[model samples]
Target: MFVIGLTGGIGSGKSTAGEIFAELGVDVIDTDQIARLLTQSGGAAIPAICGLFGDAYITESGALDRQKMRQLIFSDSAHRQKLERLLHPLILDEVSSHVQRSLSQYVIVVVPLLLETGDYDHLIQRVLVIDCDEQLQVTRTMARSRLSAADVKAIMATQVDRQFRLTKADDIVRNNRDFGHLRAQIVRLHHFYLTLAE
Candidate 1:
């Protein structure tokens, strides 16, 4: 089936865009959601995580200690890579399974780190980036995640810059405006994708 890889940096509204596509009756497989499920209590990745980092990174409820792990990984790229190494393959497998089972004309797979990791490149026919101002990204992330501006910026630093990401996009959705504007662009794109699927 035709596949679109949806991506953006932190708080650039990739999830919102994915939701819009889903509302348009497109199948959306979100890697972040898959990752969350795999890191929750009794998740498949828990055993490997505990084996690699020990129980210190696991909460009393047996879920990955997100805050603690975030602090460790963000502060050290080595730790981040280690975690990614352990989880990326599993996430990709699940994404592949979902894509194989999808009944839509086309599928949109949301992978926030699509560009950075390049792990899902083989699975995507096109790349659609949700673009917004850097400051807006920081503000949105800070508001929703309760992260400091510095923390938000730090996360942004790990992602591809706006210009570089835009250069690589097969389609772009500028989400710098209101929800109505965003929806309009998505609707337009939905029609475009439908034509492509045919």
Candidate 2:
């Protein structure tokens, strides 16, 4: 299937963009959702994560303690890399399976770290980045995740800067406005992608 890799930094509204595409009948696969599944109770990655990061990172319910893990990764670059090394392959495998079985005209793979990781380069035919102002990103994320402005800034720091992400996009969706504006843009792209899929 032709794959459109949708990416944006935290709080850039990529999830909303993906949902818009999904409403237009496009199949959407989100790596973040897959990652969460893999770290849930009795999940595939729990054993490896426990062995690598120790048991403290695992909740009593046998799921990943995301807050603890997030703090660790943000504090130590090496630990971040280690976590990626463990999760990336598994996530990619699941993504591939979903793409193969999908019946939609084209698949929109929502990968927030598409540029930062570069693992989906060969799998995607087009890169669609959801763009927005940096301050807006920080504000949206702080509200949604209850993170302090500084903590949100720290997460933003780990992602590719806005300018760089824009440069890497094959298509860009400006998301600095209201939902109606975003839906209109997505509706336009839906038609564009349908033609490409043919």
lDDT of 1 by residue, 1-198 (tens): 999999988999999999999999999999999999999999999999999999999999999999999999999999999999999999999999999999999999999999999998799999999999999999999999999999999899888888999999999999999999999999999999999999
Q: State, as a TM-score between 0 and 1, how close model 2 is to the true structure.
A: 0.99
**TM-score per model over all chains:** 0.99, 0.99
Residue 190 in candidate 1 has what lDDT? 98
Deviating ranges (above 4 Å) for candidate 2:
none
Candidate 1 RMSD computed on C-alpha atoms after optimal superposition onto the true structure: 0.6
